[model samples]
Target: MPYLTTADGAEIFYKDWGTGQPIIFSHGWPLNSDAWDVEMKLAADNGFRAIAHDRRGHGRSTSTYTGNDMDTYAADLAALVDALNLTDIILVGHSTGGGEVVRFAAQHGAGRVVKIATAGAVPPVMVKSDTNPEGTPIEVFDSIRAGVLADRSQFYQDLSAQFFGTNREGSTISQGQRDQFWRQGMQVGLAAAYDCVKAFSETDFTEDLKALDVPIFIAQGADDQIVPIDDAAMKSINLVKNGTLKVYPGAPHGIAGSYQQELDKDLLEFWLS
Candidate 1:
């Protein structure tokens, strides 16, 4: 229920729990702080401060139509960290949230942050271009936009099913997980979600990855349909100066949710190392 007012006056909702080393989490597109619930609790229970915030226009945050881009997202995160005067932070991000964390490190993190981690993240670039020919086609993202404009609810439901690999063969997901995904997606603003499709798909994080002087932990889903491994975390890992890359076999975009226990253990190890 806590909120932090951004420089632009947007009310950003955040959850801060426990105390000790701070681990800040940033959720993916159209999702809220709830996306990091499992990770946050795990970290908090282990004597770490876990914090996550709803990006503007998502979840309980103010639903502003403008500033749905990466810059604003990064700035909002930086503002939250500054407001709390948090230090020695371990910043973790998923998908678009990964983009937010890297951008924050490159632009504003500096002395305040200790390390960075991203899973199934969108970085370096997700849309194809001359430089990133392996990226997903712009047409694919266009379809996503059309889907959102058509039926946001159905679109989110379908995505939730695929996001966690529930639609894949030999896969099973709980009703609670499905409901959580749909619930988080439905909480986002329609306009903000629409604009964010472009923001996450097109924004380049090349410089951000290259600028990372601290140790970075990169996790990629080998079967991720949303952001392919080659174009995202894989390439991002190569750019970081002190990066450790891990590829989860058969994992989808929602690795943090689908493989929560493994991810929690890996993160704890990373924090200790």
Candidate 2:
């Protein structure tokens, strides 16, 4: 129930706990702050202040249908930073949340950020434009957007399988895993999620990635179907002034959660280094 109101009077729900350099997490489309718990708790145990916010319409936050664009997302995040007066934050984002990290850093600068990282992020543009000719096709995003509008629940359900899933974990799929994913999506405002489809798919963040002045890392699942390593992580590495890429072979899009121990270890090393 804890939430902070943004500059535009939007009530942004967030979890701010623990102590040390703040680690702010931005989650992917349709999912909320709960997505970052494993990472947040680990950081907290290691003496870091970990925070995660539910994008306006998702999770327990107010489910307003407006302000679902990338700029608004960045602004909402900035408001949380300002409200907490967070200093020395390490911003970590996944999927669409990755784009949020990039846009937030570029718009607000790293006034209190020591590092920024993206995991299976959607950046450097997701859908191919003239400048990014190698990007994902327009029809791909259009089809996804259409699918969401057509049947929000079913589309999200199918997407959960496509996104969180990869055979690398195992050939067999677990019902618990599938149910957990479904629960996360069902906890949000359907309308907000529908609009977010386009925001995440089409938002361009080339300048944002390039302008990052702080240390940045990108961990991408090589076999991820949702956001290809080449389109998001590799491209980000090439753009950021000081950036590194970590490729997780045969991992799923939800590698951040599925492969927590491995990722946490890698991240801690990076943080201390």
TM-scores, in order shown?
0.97, 0.94
For each candidate in the order shown, give its overall lDDT on alpha carbons: 0.90, 0.83
lDDT, candidate 2, equals 0.83
- lDDT for 137 in candidate 2 is 90
| Best candidate, lDDT | 1
Cα lDDT for residue 236, candidate 1? 87
Please tell me which predicted candidate would have the highest TM-score against the true structure. Answer: 1
Local accuracy of candidate 1 as per-residue lDDT tens digits, 1-273: 899999889999999999999999999988999889888898899899999999999999999999999999999998899899999989999999999999999999899889998998899899999988888999999999999999989998889877888888977677688788889999999889999999999999999899989999998778888888888877887899999999888888885455766777898888777
- Give lDDT tens digits, candidate 2, residues 40-132: 888889888889999988988878788998999999998888888878878899998999988998998467777988888999888888888
* Ten-residue stretch with the least lDDT total in model 2: 166-175
Off by over 4 Å in 2: 166-169, 256-258
TM-score of 2: 0.94
